[model samples]
Target: MALKELEVRYATKRSRDYKLADGEGLHLLVRPNGSKLWRMKYRFEGREKLLSFGAYPQLGLAEARLKRAAARLELAAGRDPGARPDRKPAMTFEKAARAWHEHRAASLDPGHAARTLARLERDAFPALGKTDIRAVTSADVLAMVRSVEARGALDVSRRLKQHVSQIYRFAIPHGWADTDPAAYLSDLLKPKPRVRHMARVGMEELPKLVQAIDAYDGEETPRRRAVTRAALLFTLFSWARTNETRLATWDEFEGLETAEPLWRVPAARMKMEREHLVPLSTQAAALLVSLREISKTGFVFPGDKPNQPISQNTMIYGCYRMGYRGRQTVHGFRGLASTWANEAESYRPDWIEMALAHAERDEVRGAYNSALYLTPRRRMLQDWGNLVEHMVTSDAGVRRDDVEEVGPPLTAVA
Candidate 1:
């Protein structure tokens, strides 16, 4: 059953591929296509595995035996040479993902860098992380993307797909990979899902909603009720995102009691992972002043648990309670302010955009100064805060006593 060089060269093609024995699990596979290939079987980690040497003729019997002996040596030393780190077979998706992330960590904002890994762990890693980078097919990458897509996270799906593509491209020059499986993946993508911005409300609805918020009496605990109200009002007055609002700490606020107040949201807390300065309107600063009284914990809006930030869903449910659940969102306050300012048309659009902390189209302008449009923004926020007070205090066909309590005594969804 031993494979001889002359005999293997003359071996006839079979209806199906058959192996010519060379003992020790090494064999010459005679394919129907008249090709002779060398292969060996071995074991590692209590599992049987296979390794390829080379094609016969080019890899004669003596050389094949040498390669097999080397492989067995590697196995005895507790190594799988078949999947060595230098080889394509050993390059795992998780390993490559780590490499790609680390390669750009220095340049990327820490928060963005952290989220990229977090997302890969959450969505891609569980499915294909251990798979060999070369072994991962386009179908494999698409399957991972579709899982996110099925949840209707269209933007997340797109972002994750781009990440997969980047991973493959990064691995290519490093020699751990050869093929770009993620290339041209968008062709296989399902129909574009609707663009879903965070749920937020317009100006006309802002006032009526505020009136309902005032009526929210939570179990008659005045401190908790007051904290909740202040949190939402603070979110509006600062035009900060829910996470920004909830996680805000007293130390981050400067000059709240002074003539000029500023809430400096650090890069770690921002979506873009950059430092943002929020010019506090009198109302916003006043809310923070009141908040400091009740909050012994550093977090401006402490959660039910001590010292922790408030639940992200707290304000959304507050909206739900006010019978404006669908009509308004905690984030909608930003949109409302934007709407009010743009309609005012008195301020420059760039200044308004800067106030909103939108990523500036001009990179130079975006990164130029943290307080690029401070004076005008202070005035804009003051005017907006005045509008908010009028909306909350004035009767806009919504009586305070008539509004319902927060979505029925349910535990706040964390």
Candidate 2:
């Protein structure tokens, strides 16, 4: 009997490598690491022979059968199916994208590399992955951009275009193709009116978000529940971007035993090659101290998998479970903090921007320890953390009584 697609797919790896038969000398070779490659056996010129037909799913059952029939035909004609001198490997988009991603990822940071490939897998692969690199036309690229734009994500459309261009740029040097089809379509795309902002809840709506987070126990494991709570609360207190928080290491912290603790983000890990100094608030410092009792490695927030950082998606999906899927991102906490600080006007614009690790008005400034006012920034962060704690636990949602108790500090944050 022929092998069913389901059986071929559901086959699991064993301690030792093994194979599965499909009755006509066709077999699925299963490696211990779970890779399944298709192979066929036959006899030619009074000698028993075997031929590998490539990996399963990539070369399916029907295609394998066709190749087998063709091989038999060639053998009957006294020609060799096992060897083809004229054959050249197909230039598939998957092939080129893998090559490009590998080469491009080397020059980029770990976080950016992971995200770029993820987009390729999700958006680009299904449509163009198998297409020949040289055969892809501008029309094909247009359809892809239009498909994403139809979903109302103009930013995603732009990113897809940029990644495609990079892939083609890589292919040309490697002798895969001539010109980039995606490059020609740049003129056709309408410029986005403004950069889309990360979704964030206003002060009036914050208590509901906090209540949902506090009530969350997570669906699967105890670690999941604990990680969710710690990550969410840390984000609320520190107001850092998702990736920055998720990939945080224990070595990045300093002065945790003192009243003025800080998180020193290294340049290589940052978006730009500039060091960012984050003043740890009283609550923020406490969270780190609690995390210290259990962490076995340098990772402040360890991942579910051994020797891995906490996943960026896991942090974002915490709110997805809280029924704020489209209304809040992990970075939304930063947006909320930015809004509150600017509105309060207790601190100067430079102080708030510096605290956020954003560029200064001069665009080229001294390091955080020298130029930016650390003393004032520390006080600003503490004030913000205190307000956030009140918001998280308050029942009346920062009503008149809550507002009256906390006033901006009398001393100027100069």
lDDT against the true structure, each candidate:
0.75, 0.74
lDDT of 1 by residue, 1-414 (tens): 676678878988987767788898798878777878787876678655566677878988999999999988988898976675754446689999999999989987778788888999999999889887766767678888899988988768877888998898799779776556677787777777565776666565666666666555542455556667777777777788888888888899899888799999988877666788888887777667655656889898887897787787877877776677577788778888888899999888877887877877675666574556888989998888777776554343322332221221111110
lDDT of 2 by residue, 303-405 (tens): 7788677787887788888788899887888788888889998988777877777755352354233466788888888998777666555342222321122
If scored against the real structure, what TM-score would every candidate get? 0.57, 0.49
For model 2, the run of ten residues with the poorest summed lDDT: 405-414
Off by more than 4 A, model 1: 1-96, 109-111, 121-137, 147-156, 168-180, 190-219, 258-260, 264-277, 303-305, 308-328, 347-379, 389-414
lDDT of 1 at 409: 13
Winning candidate number (TM-score): 1
Superposed by TM-score, candidate 1 places the C-alpha of residue 176 at a distance from the truth, in angstroms, of 6.3
